[model samples]
Target: MFKQKYGTTALVAGASEGMGAAYAHALASRGMNLVLIARRKEELEATAADIATRYGVKVLPVVCDLAAPDATQQIIHVIGDTAIDFLVYNAALSFIGPYLSTGPSTHLDIAAVNVQTPLALLHYFGGKMVARRRGGIVMMASLAGFQGSGFLATYGASKAFDRVLAEGLWYEWKPFGVDVIACCAGATATPNYNNTHPRKGSFLEPKAQLPAQVVEECLQKIGTVPSFVSGTGNKLVSFLLSHVLPRKKTVKIMGDSMHKIYGSKWESN
Candidate 1:
């Protein structure tokens, strides 16, 4: 059922490694051909080759920076007339320190990668999906988006946009046979996450999930809900933050956790 509905070809942005690569592999395993996009050429091509070999499905690797102004056009140009049945927008930029420490350009770039590009791509591909009357979209959101995270302020705000966008689109597009979902993942063992060097024994480290686990859970829940926090622990935490706790308390909890993880690297503006 999954393959038949969304199996023709899937496009995974930021598919060079980590969760994006995992999404690509999962879709390929389900018999979907793929068009993988990322900034790193070698890594992207290597991932595409490996998936094609392992799953015996067509894989096209397109190297393009999602932060670029013309990212959506670049992807569309590369894919040509090939129809994309599913889209996984996984590209994101984050700054994990005092928000004011970074220059305005850095925050703008984060907004571009995390919010603007995804919105543009959704408008492009989502329209096609609605027209075809069959498709799916998975926008990678984050648990931090639930509140005003201290260090990840801008990134969280951008993800909040994605989460709401997906929810609204899910409602508007479902009638047209298109399934849109936002996978609000918690801490996962992705390269980008690991690069942050989260403090060991911190509250988030113990709860960190594997990329494959995150991707699998996301795939399972895509057509069932507009959005979901991936993982059992994450669900519990999300529930507490959103329902049980007050908004002020929720923001403080996230702020404290982020401070614990990246406080050492914090710089004064």
Candidate 2:
């Protein structure tokens, strides 16, 4: 029961892999043509070909880092003259480990990928959507966004900004029949886990969620809510963390764990 059923066209960032790939497939299954953006050109092309073959949706690939200055304009150009009714701004980068230990430039780059690009996408496409008065957007956020972290401070903080921004926009746009969803997904298995957490295993190998679970959720509920935490387990963790744990304690525990796992990777696991 997607509130905004896929009809005309859709734009998705980070559409080459993980949840973004799942989202592109779901939208294609709903009969929407897609313009997909990702840093990897070959991967984007491959995904487009697969989707085109299987779902028959016209898939356009825009290879971009998105953290670059020209990214917004480049995307706008690709979307020229297309009536985009759905936009999934799901591309994000997470650099785990201590904030102070990481280089300032690296943190800035993380901000560029996680916060800046999405902001640009919203500004560029949101204006057009509002003018048309018919579009829906999902800004892929994480449960990590809900609170501060010790090891993953920058990533969590940026996602916090994303979640709030999406919620604020959702309220302002829904009356215009536009839905801005802030999806807070928990630890669903994706390649990016290495970037987000201090782990050393494939997200697949039966540990975390398959990409399909997140995609399935996004497809079923397009615009009914401002936010949707992806899995029940994730939802529960967020709930407990929100209600049970004190801020200082949580930060301490997270920091210690990170120190054990990532900050000292040379040490035996």
In order of appearance, the predictions have TM-scores of 0.96, 0.90
- Please tell me which predicted candidate would have the highest TM-score against the true structure: 1
**How does each model score on lDDT?**
0.90, 0.79
lDDT of 2 by residue, 1-269 (tens): 34344347888899998889998988888788899999999999999999999998799999989889778888878668777778998888777665665679888888898888888888878878888888889888887677776677888899889889999999998888787888888677787764556462222112356778877786566678888888776676666667889977656655665566576653433
Give the clash count for each candidate.
Answer: 0, 0
lDDT of 1 by residue, 3-46 (tens): 89775899999999999999999999899999999999999999
Residue-level error in angstroms, candidate 1, position 52: 1.0
Alpha carbon RMSD to native, model 2: 3.4
**Decoy 2 TM-score against native:** 0.90
